[model samples]
Target: DAGITQSPRYKITETGRQVTLMCHQTWSHSYMFWYRQDLGHGLRLIYYSAAADITDKGEVPDGYVVSRSKTENFPLTLESATRSQTSVYFCASMGVAGDNEQFFGPGTRLTVL
Candidate 1:
């Protein structure tokens, strides 16, 4: 999967705490991604994985960590949460032949106090 990023529907955490948002897909897509949605920037890429154990940073990778040890799961971690990191996170997946087509999961809205 190369096109969709998904996560839980909602989350709330305090500043300086660690948070992990998990994304899961039933289909074994070749590419999976993580993105954050904010007021001015729309959706910005955070990280992406081409396959299990193969991950790369995206547009806004700072303060974030991602891992893909399984095709169905891509987890994004915030080592130490901050108020500026509060936003809606998305998880997406795309098949090999679906050019520019991605299946998106229900987004997670994280609020850091």
Candidate 2:
């Protein structure tokens, strides 16, 4: 496995501002997912994509948008940042099936001020 990585490992932003977190993998995995880690909720799914250009909403996608125009890259954007959205975001990718082990990026810590 080539593994996965994320950009801007740490970020601090104000509420109402737009911010984006980038994720890239070299394994060419068929499935990718975005999730956020919070204090109480633990980890909540934000979005996922089965393939390039094919995406879907996950559990908490209200303030976020995602796109997968290429198999190796999936980026998550917060249209308007909110304090509640501040959390550590993780990007993960899996092979053929969802049951397969998912390779996760280092994570991006976003703090909405």
Candidate 2 lDDT for residue 86:
82
Per-residue C-alpha lDDT of model 2 across residues 40-90, encoded as one tens digit per residue: 788999999999999999998898999999999999999999999889999
| Error in Å for residue 60 of model 1 | 0.4
lDDT to native, each model: 0.89, 0.93
Residue pair clashes in candidate 2: none
Question: The CA-based lDDT of model 2 is what?
Answer: 0.93
- Residue lDDT tens for model 1, 1-113: 44344555788999999999989887788889898999999999999998899999999999999998899999999999999999999999877875747888889999999
All candidates: CA RMSD in angstroms? 2.9, 1.7
lDDT of 2 at 101: 85
Give the top-scoring candidate (TM-score).
2
What TM-score does prediction 1 earn? 0.91
